[model samples]
Target: MKLDILAIGAHPDDVELGCSGTLISEARRGKKVGIVDLTQGELGTRGTVETRYAEAAEAGRIIGVSVRENLKMRDGFFVNDEAHQLQLIRVLRRYRPDIVIGNILEDRHPDHGRAGNLIYDACFLSGLKQIKTAEDDGSEQEKWRPRYLFQYIQDRFYEPDLIVDVSHVWEERMASIKAYTTQFHSPAGTEGDATYISSPEFMEAVIARARLLGKRIGVPFAEGFLSKKNIGISSLDALVLQET
Candidate 1:
């Protein structure tokens, strides 16, 4: 199916952690959205790849995305090479999404930056007529370049070029994130070594960041994003702003 947006991340929960609120809000408006996880997050400290796949499926259900596909690339080892770009190009052409959401350009985790650059390149390459790719059904795919590519804000702070107000759907977004039981802060789960994001504080910080972004735009909550291209709007009145 043709998608309005395809959100890509380096790992299973990356989209959820970064842009799930925006995804959920857009899907509620009848937008067809999909997710492409570059890796299954096999290298995470807490959950196995099998468990992460299951949890990612649950997260997809919560966000109401039409589909979620994994590239099965090596966790933490995947590089921005020709092979990786070709795999992403195939999906990009197959979906023919109008927009693509990707990981932060730079983040605490190296994989996030690599995936961001890889996707950025693939999106551009997908539009090249000379580049060839095939669908799963073995049919030759047509070239498709998304109209917009966005970078979701992650661990590190960067001034966002765009902020999406997600106040109406914030709770649903949080629920979608909580669906990743094995990855996030779950007191009931089996005790294991805690990582940077496994702690309750990390979740709190994510929420806090949303609030800050929301406050900047006079909303209850929002998600921040950076864009490689300068954003344009038709009118100043269309922009949400803090009331004086």
Candidate 2:
């Protein structure tokens, strides 16, 4: 199915912590949005692959995305090679999204940067007719390329080229994030290894990052994104505010 937006991440909860608010807001506006996780985060300290899948599914439901797919790539060792790119390319061609959101180019986790490069390369290669991919029905799919590509801010702070005001959907965004019980801020009864993200402090940092981005647009919360190309707007009013 054609999707308006496809958000991809190196791991299951990455998208949730990064751009789920923007996804939620856009879905509310009648846009079809989906998610593609590069890995199941199997190497994560707290959750097993099976549990991560269940949590990811719950998160997808909370975010209101039309689909959520995992490539099942090796969590920490996946490379930006042809085999991995083809996997991403197949999904890109299958969904034919107009816009694509990917992991931060550089982050606290090495996987994030690797996936960012992989997604970027797959996006470019998917547009080439020479690269063949087939759907499950055995029919060959046409080459497709997403028009827009943006990288969501994650563990590391990036000076974003664009920021979307997501203050209105902030609560829902947090709800979706909390859905990954095994990954972050676990409830009293749930058991998990205390990792960097298992504590509530990590979530607080996420909120702080959103707040920092929102300050640029005078909003309570926002999501920041980085783009390789310059962004354009139709009018001066789209500037949000002018510099003093």
Tens digits of per-residue lDDT for model 1, 1-244: 9999999999999999889999999999999999999998988988788888888998899999999999999999999999999999999998999999999878999999999999999999999999988887889999999999999998999999999999999888998888877777876554689888888999999999999999888888999999988788899988665785
**Candidate 1: stretches off by over 4 Å:** none
User: Cα lDDT of all candidates, in order?
Assistant: 0.92, 0.90
Q: Can you give the TM-score per candidate against the true fold?
A: 0.96, 0.95
- Best model number under TM-score: 1
Instruction: Tell me model 1's lDDT, rounded to 2 decimals.
Output: 0.92
Per-residue error at 173 for model 2, in Å? 0.2
Tell me the lDDT of candidate 2.
0.90
